[model samples]
Target: MRITRYIVITLAAATFLTGQGMHRETAERMKDRGLSTLDSYEMLKELTGTIGHRLSGSDGYEKAVLWSQRRLKEAGADSVWTEPVMVPRWVRGPVEKAFARSGGKNHELTVCALGGTVGTEKKGVTGRVIEVRSFDDVRALGESAKGAVLFFNRPFDRTRVNTGEAYGGAVNQRGSGAIEAAKVGAVGVIVRSMTNAMDDEPHTGAMRYDSAVPKIPAAAVSTMDAEMLSALLKKDPGTTVTIQLSAQSHPDVLSSNVIGEIRGSEFPEQIVLVGGHLDSWDKGTGAHDDGSGVAQSIEVIKLMKALGLRPKRTIRVVLFANEENGLKGALAYASRDANVRERHIAAIESDAGGFLPRGFGISADSIKFGKLTQYASLLDVVGAGKITAGGGGADIGPLKPFGTALIGLSPESQRYFDYHHSNHDTIDKVHPRELELGAIAMAILSWAIAQDGL
Candidate 1:
């Protein structure tokens, strides 16, 4: 009886080892296949080149929805569908112009209107620019800021090693500057573009207003222009600037989130999701901001099909809508009924960019993270084995309450900010090999989680 018990225990150990070995081998094959084919890059080129930018409520976004459905079907998704979502419709009208007049000279400045901000009057708004590093600085001046252009000139903290951290440190000025400046009776708001690169290209992003205070036009000036404006202010405090923006916000419109899935062979009810926001800021083609992410999400389905790897849990790909200015698509998906929510065991989002592949960032408890680390060895081949805590995508953030294990694909981020929300974010910036490697990493992780729960 003792010998029989020992044999049973030894066989169980052997089975577990064999299963892990198979996962490792599968990961290697996925890497080789992905690197050789470079399918993700091709898909991205087609999407960006054909669809252009896919800002919510735009014609391009509508075309992208149809394009996504077709591509997912081609990628061998067992089922594909769209979920309805209502999104804000904002238009950056025909013109956006700005210039500074000081020191007896006119300096042309590159600028773009912040999304959802009110437009300037037909003649535009001209005011003596008062540069402030923070909202506190505006309040310190009391009524002095009234009728002036409040310039939020807080630049990205260059000292921070991580560019994302630097962006976070300074981004508040762009998002809330209008409301804060309005409180001080400011006529307009000019914010420094949120990027580390010292370029003349303005970066546009979402901004909001307070119903209590009057709404005002908000725009982002290039980093170089911000520097110039600051110097002009220091030299001559009476320096004035003129800003003209035709941007306008319209009524909400109907949209949808594109979804496709590969059914699990065993645990069909359980699910693992791969996703990225489909809507991008209208400035550029959005190659890096989330175009790469969308391509990578769909590539996971393609890779699994090509390798004939049938996961034990369903693998779904979601291309979220309106992530640029709003999170309506994310909210709509997360608000599904309890039965649908409980089936989601894990979700992975690749919204960072198409940069070189790094490890994933996980947002889960210690027990689940430990279980997840068991598959880290399989990811080493692609150099995505490094895993940290506290990470998820903006689109998948709502799933946290349901206890979904959220994962974010953390690619190298140094260059992402340079192009984010600017015209520089084009497909040419993304490396084909790097993009494919990211997809390979996601595929391997999804498969591992599908085979073994959590």
Candidate 2:
């Protein structure tokens, strides 16, 4: 009788464990069904190819707003509308270049005018080039510089683990080279493109003139051309270069932050935000830089609606404008009334290029992050299980003051810098499948958060 009782107890315990395993399998299967039904490819195609590059205050950006509103409405989202915001309107005017001649031969170089730079009075500026590798070198040449164009030929350090770090290292030169050059009476400034690869495509970014220093024309030369110009200058110190930039900043313009929301069934007041900048540098089609992110954000809503999944928390999709030259859209959204700000629970941004979905970089405390990782199995289906805490996109950075948990999508970084801020950041650079995978991962994560109330 004792032996029989022991056998019965062991069997009962095994049966209970088996039943729990089945229940867990059933739950996973339901989650997988939800994930598999989401069509990420079609959504990406409609956004990237249909909308193209959506620079802030440009026609593309406006059209994208309309497209998002219409699509969100069609996707059964509760509401979609535009929020008023002032945006910068900087035009990339005609860029012309002629190399300084020293040996009686003209060396032609490629260049693009930096955003917000003043056009060289119709005829343009011609002067001898003064090359400097670092900001200290420019400081050392203070006062002695007069009517000379300061050339910032700092190359991006390729050894950095994060290419974004390399870009940060070199971007200061482009952003403030004109102002620094003007401090010492320099007529203009030419900065080397912030790129790791040696190419002939000039990267254009926002450059600000210090209110104290006189404003002057500024542009970025391709890395290849910068190197060639440097080598030529070494041989001939008396080389003269002529730069003609037509780019100019127009008056502040009326723009908007496009917002669409799928009202939650239970917690309609609580909100979860997902977004990306709807702007790009005026060079190539801003496909990878942010077009991918914009499209992916939109698709998250579309996919959730198509799957007929009603999340418990309000899911708001925002397509921010002016993230390239300025963060006017992001700022406008963050500066809302206190009542509205208090309702925001979390925000996720995907400004990282449309590369493969490697994982998500979260910016939340241990408790919140621990809860987020519980859904890791659901996210792993879409290839985004690698969740590390600590990182937020620039557009979403301002929301931190509100105590909102910020999260940024982290994709494979192997080739993001290859086309970032370059003319090569076109639609062709992005793989459709990879782009869809990213959107799907975002949708799944957002859905899980909404349902689980994280």
In terms of lDDT, the best-performing candidate is 1
**Leading candidate by TM-score:** 1
After TM-score superposition, the amount by which residue 168's alpha carbon in candidate 2 deviates from its true location, in angstroms, is 1.7
Q: Alpha-carbon error at 365 in model 1, in Å?
A: 1.2
Superposition TM-score, candidate 1 onto the true structure: 0.96
Give each model's whole-structure lDDT: 0.91, 0.78
Tens-digit lDDT track of model 2 for 203-231? 87788888998889988888888998898
Per-residue lDDT over 1-454 for candidate 1, one digit per residue giving the tens place of the 0 to 100 score: 9999999989976875787898899999999999999999998999899999988999999999999999899999999999999999999998798888898888888899999988888788989899999879988967998899999998889998778889889998988999999998999989999999998999999898899999989999999999999999899888888889999889999999999999999988898999999999998899998999999999999999998888989999999999989899999999987446348889999988999878899999898887777667788889998888878899999988878899999999899999999999999999999999999999999998898777
TM-score of each: 0.96, 0.89
How displaced is residue 304 in candidate 1, in Å?
Answer: 0.6
lDDT of 2: 0.78
Model 2 misplaced regions, further than 4 Å: 1-51, 338-342, 373-377
